[model samples]
Target: MTTREWAGDAETRQVTEVASERELRELIGEPNDRAANKIRSRLHDLDRQWLARSPFCYLATADAEGRCDVSPKGDPAGFTLVLDDATLAIPDRPGNKRLDGFRNILANPQVGLNYVLPGRSDTLRINGRGRILRDAPFFDDMVVKGNRPRLALLVEIDEVFYHCSKAFLRSQLWQPESWQPDAVPSRARIAKGIEAPDIPLEQLEAHYGAGYADRLYG
Candidate 1:
């Protein structure tokens, strides 16, 4: 589709775009002074506590060319190790070997992480530089089911803060009654369109399910 068609129309595009920070700030108004001041350049004790209780987080990274990706990382609570006030170590669990986000981190050290807990509305956000570590000591600490990760992402903190609960409140994300059931296509089904079409759907599902069910750890 053409740019104009994809963006709705010229008027819609013009209305949505704010060309400069000045213009954007004018539209949204200044952020809260207290909120702005709350952002820490390092992880504090409270931040460490939050990470300790978080079983899931989203790791966001962008390549040198600015191509971005967000990948979900989850484990038991406290799976992410706070190596100190300034560093965090996240084990790179076994997966399909795409490594899109990890490759982006190699090209561009900058990364963002958002930590979430099951019933909590507020999420902790961490912005930092990342490096891949394959050292035995790093992997030794993150072993799961006798399987140690072959690699870990070490993050040096730059900014850390708690995002407000407005988003979760608006979506009612934690409320079961607010959720709607839907039939979601499996990854195998989606891949068949662009990949191995000759593979039977049942075979693909069986393989995929078994991998997730039995081989989650590396």
Candidate 2:
């Protein structure tokens, strides 16, 4: 089929598959349901406290191989620094030498970022075109002691939205007073368990801990 015809055919819905409200909403569930009212247009600016309150985030990217990578980034709330309404910069904190996320960016410029706020019920999701920025852009994010990062990844945001962290609230994510130690695994021990063919996970942990102090903020 021609390109236009193929696109049309894909969008044409069969009338036989009509869905019942109970079946649809029940399947979609409450948390996944659309909000009664939603904001239009992306907010170019970020509220300062959002960055200050966030302790962890996940970076998602897809490479030419069609394999996708999702990596966790964390720090004392505010490791991610927003430069302006149009640009957001993340300090490339050191990790295992794998650099899977960075490598994927070289082959694919698209990225999805989810910034999670600590003890809060809302998170930020952003989709953007990203590029590696150097020199001043990199230096501006430096810490008082760590020096500066070699470079920073600059993301030119296309769209951004806030998600209600209903699940987190239901799970009592931030209620540290009631949290059980067994709920979360110790990073050090968890790292010691994984044994990859190419690189031992324990070795990766050692390298990450050694370099993180110097790479982040510095």
How high is the CA lDDT of each candidate model?
Answer: 0.87, 0.71
Candidate with maximal lDDT: 1
- Which portions of model 1 miss their true places by more than 4 Å? 1-16, 186-188, 191-196
Worst 10 residues of 2 by lDDT: 1-10
Off by over 4 Å in 2: 1-41, 44-46, 183-188, 196-218
Deviation (Å) of 48 in candidate 2: 3.9
Q: Write the per-residue lDDT of candidate 1 for residues 1-218, one digit (tens) a residue.
A: 11332356444452334468888787788888998699898888888889989999999999999999999999889999998899999998878799999899889999999999998999999999999988757678788888788889999999999998999999999999887644556777866666779898887787777576676773
Compute the lDDT for candidate 1.
0.87
Candidate 2 per-residue C-alpha lDDT over 43-97 given as tens digits, one digit per residue, 9 for 90 to 100: 4435456766787899999898879999998777787777777577886655556
Give per-residue lDDT, candidate 1, residue 187.
77
